[model samples]
Target: MTSAVTTDNSARPGYGQLLRTPGALGFVLPGFAARLPFGMLTISILLLVQHTTGSYGSAGIVAAVTGISMALSAPLMGILTDRFGQSAVLVPVVLAHAAAVGGLAALALADANVWFLALAAVPTGASVPQVGPMVRARWAARLEGSPLLPTAAAFESVTDEFTFVVGPVLATALCTGVHPAAGLVTEATLTLLGGLLFAARRASQPRTHAPSATGESRSFALSHPGLQVLILAFLGIGAVFGGMQVSLAAFSAEIGNPGANGLLYGVFAAGNMIAGIAMGAVAWKIGPRRRLILGYVGLTAAASVLWAANSVILLGALGLVVGLFIAPALITGYTMVEQLVPANARTEAFTWLTGSIAFGQAVAVILAGRLTDAHGSAYGFLVPMAATALALAVLLALRAKLAPKAPSRIVNASVSAPVSAAAPVSTSAGASAPGSEAAAGPRDRVNERGMGHRVPVTVD
Candidate 1:
């Protein structure tokens, strides 16, 4: 019976089961709306600053400054969320973000100095809510020991890709068809309203606990060598995003149809979303660590040819391929946090990964923008290829560090059974244990804190 159950694909829980978990929809809906601005803000800034300054270089600098600020501040915000709880940290942050966005838009429209615009960007980006990470933390808490954790990670990635699809299109349409500043205004509005609504879902927010007696709380997420590798790899992914955004816009402008930037970007993001959906649905036999390396290799391969795409159709097709390969890498990274970090630091860990992407994007945006301005949009494509290749090398060198430092043990409370640390947990249905890399699903088991409930625990 156990063998039959393990072999039967139908026994695995689907996305519907994951979503039906209590209080999931309450936060997921508002969380989706809040994060739309994540995709909008940078593009809107690039377009608006370019419109005002008449230089892609200048626009890129401002956008890059914003990305850098976000990268620097995200982990700090995560620490606050972990210490003070999500709603308490988010309410003030969102309010500040809205105000800063308004000020940045005003300065640009008023033809303020580039330095002033850049300075204003600091607060704007710093205060932008880390909605994506927060939401994922909530999922981590709600589905801690469940098999649905990987599905949740994939679902969040899909949500992110969907927003990217809609955000660029909306921002581009508003800026081109309505007014240059319209996109920024709309982005600010959504950030404020959606952020507040998402913050108000306190019932679903992860509980923030006080520090343990051992002073374990002082440990930062980056202290883990494995997490550092993941961050570096994600930075490369960020380069892909930054490279594509500027290059796509520059290409569209070069072709005498600037409005097409949104459409092209949308197609790229649609591929990512589709892949996320597929990744979540599959019961994978391969480990996430191996899957991550494979996904990134494919992404790097697809990115290598982006410089050769001269036509809109060709660029879009190449971009689609790049997008398809990115989702697995991203989902795997997020899923791996459960095994690498303690529950208390999971939120901060997620933010570190996110911040690395922002930092990478910032660097790429400036490089790509200058390259596009000097040579052409085609030259900007080199950033992602080089970045991914370099990151892949780092990942390969540190591949051994990606494994969990300690073996995971499952304690079954119903029967008071103690599973061997070196062996897989025996489920009645013979399903491979949640944390085991060999499981026919994504490995997402976290170190359970207590012994009362049946959970996987990893002792460091």
Candidate 2:
């Protein structure tokens, strides 16, 4: 009988190839628009609240509350998405977010009390659509078992960094030049329109799996020990962001150029975007776990000297270095989910990592703001250093936990015959039998079943 099983020996695809995948732009564009507001929200809230209240302390507190709320709510949203599908969860969440943000802006403009503003922030943050996690989940579903999975993860991070580059600059300009509330109003508009557009792309959304007989689908992403480690690592990264946002703004004001806050933060985010782009292009030999650890080492080293920079040029230069090292760790953490979590729990896993960053940022923003107020902007710079140091220590101690519990397997599909009749394929790391049509390339192995392809059987 003619064998229907064949191996694919194709070289790994690049970003261009990944983007060219059919229907990619359908979700990518809308997802980008929806998530751009993520970069803007914190800064917009900080500036608007600080402007109205004339107190950085109150502004920091309000922003912190928002971040904390979002961090807490993200996984819950992920659970809803995993159960009901993305469109159903996103529609109401986006609408609620727009309304909440609008109310917060109105109250800020009306000189509402800090306590009232804090209360409004709860709903505003809880309603922020989990767009980033949703997009990542789409990519995972679309590219499962393909070599381009890492590139997709890197591309997502690049997209995130690009939004940070533009979002802060746009929000700052609107708040400073147009109106104190303009930044927030624009944020709300984008969240509403972009989120609805993203939700409308039903074709690109991942299929929601029904709960298993054992209800394994109902388990939380945080139940995984590896996921917990990743979340803690991400919290450190969030601290960098939170520390940078507040400290950089304070530094700019202290240097008699408050308007330069956007430019400075933009430079930092640009560095991050650049690094992400470069990371996606390279074919690294080291595994993701090693890359993650090394990335943190570089980050901690760079962040250590940030407090000593007394000049704008120096601070910006140091900030750029810090940004440069962030992408590898961030991208690796996202990429690791493929091995660490099952397909059913992937979205929730992504959100936990994302939320931990927000939580870390929330804590750092409050602490950094108080330090800057009490001492100086230089003191605020200490937060990233401390956070990174602690994260690095944890990663070093628990490095083994990051390994996958089960070996990833390559699924061979029979194109011409039923998969059941095809001979069992080797799980080893090379070519099939000598006369086979193609060879199995390393890194092309993944446990992606039920992908709507003409697959006969999957080997465990």
Candidate 3:
């Protein structure tokens, strides 16, 4: 049963084929637009703070605060979205996010206190919609049991890579060429427009019916073993990537071509994006664990080789190699998380996955920055190498924990009935047992928390 559930639709499809799926284009494109700001916001804030306060240190602090706030708030927002409808949750969040960005821009233009800028970043970061997670959940719900899901996951990674790849370059250009405020203002505008467009698409939203059982369920996602290890693995990978970014920039500057930093980063992203595209189009017999373990080893090997290269060309080549492994790791990790948690828990689970990566990157950037300053730029490579090695070690030691339980054995087993791929999975905590509920009717019955009866829990 587990094998059937996990491996349904074994035929591999072309990367572009997933777009032919109903609602695919609508979901992916606007998600790309809203996420453009995710790639741009931190850098924009960093530059804006530096320009206003005339201190790189102060700017770094402000950026860090914003990142941490976003990471912490993401899962909370995901939970809320799962409970309330997407439009109900998303519209208000986008409005608040836009207002926050506006405040940051105004303060920067006025040359306000650095602390004030930092304070404004708190809301700005907290208000960012968990678009990536929501969209991924939607895709999984839409394409349940199809071979196309892995492809969709791969395409999702590429879209993310595209935004990050281009976002920094675009932000830097707007801030430096047009005005400091231009970058952030643009970020806010796109975020609102893209977010609203996405929210309006009711067809793609996942359904969360009332759970027939509830008290036995755990609200926190980390309670499951599979999720625990997966989240840790994601954090480690993020640290390596983050440290690599800082190290590469420092190295480029050392080579007397600071301008080449974006290009170098682009080379790395291109490798990841290209590899992701190819991987999606092929059939994979291997499970997520094997791919994940191999990806860690490849990343570590690629990052270790960076210290030996003095030329930007060699570094770029090695960065590309490192990038090649990133997508597989991410695609597998996300797929595994989806399988491990209940449908109701997916939004928060996905957000936690993303947040872990962001947290890892934030910490990596700070530590790597100090390491480069103290030991020269070459030593910065050690940061990624060490982080990757740690990830490899943990995945190996905890391999058994990551092996997923059979679908029939999930905590809410009775509630795990298969539904049509076109319909959204009910994520409600109080959903009725699958067999009983399906016997009752095709439509799902979602119980709101305040309903007048004791919520029963679903168990395998």
The number of the candidate with the highest lDDT is 2
lDDT by residue for model 2 (391-428), tens: 99999999888876644233432122223222333345
- Model 3: CA > 4 A from native: 1-11, 209-219, 409-460
Error of 1 at 119 (Å): 0.7
Candidate 3 has an lDDT of 0.76
User: On a 0 to 100 scale, what is the lDDT of residue 7 in model 2?
Assistant: 24
Query: Which 10 consecutive residues of model 3 have the lowest summed lDDT?
Result: 444-453
- Model 1 has an lDDT value of 0.82
Clash-forming residue pairs, model 2: none
For 266-334, candidate 1 gives per-residue lDDT tens digits of 888888998999988886656778888999999999999999998889988988999999999999999
Question: Candidate 3, TM-score vs. the true structure?
Answer: 0.85
lDDT of 3 by residue, 132-243 (tens): 9988989877765444567778888888888898888899899999998788998999999999998988888887534447554435676778888888888877887678
How should the candidates be ordered by TM-score, best one leading? Answer: 2, 1, 3
Q: Please report, in order, the local distance difference test score of every candidate based on alpha carbons.
A: 0.82, 0.83, 0.76
Number of the top-ranking candidate, with TM-score as the measure: 2
Model 1 alpha-carbon miss at residue 203, Å? 1.9
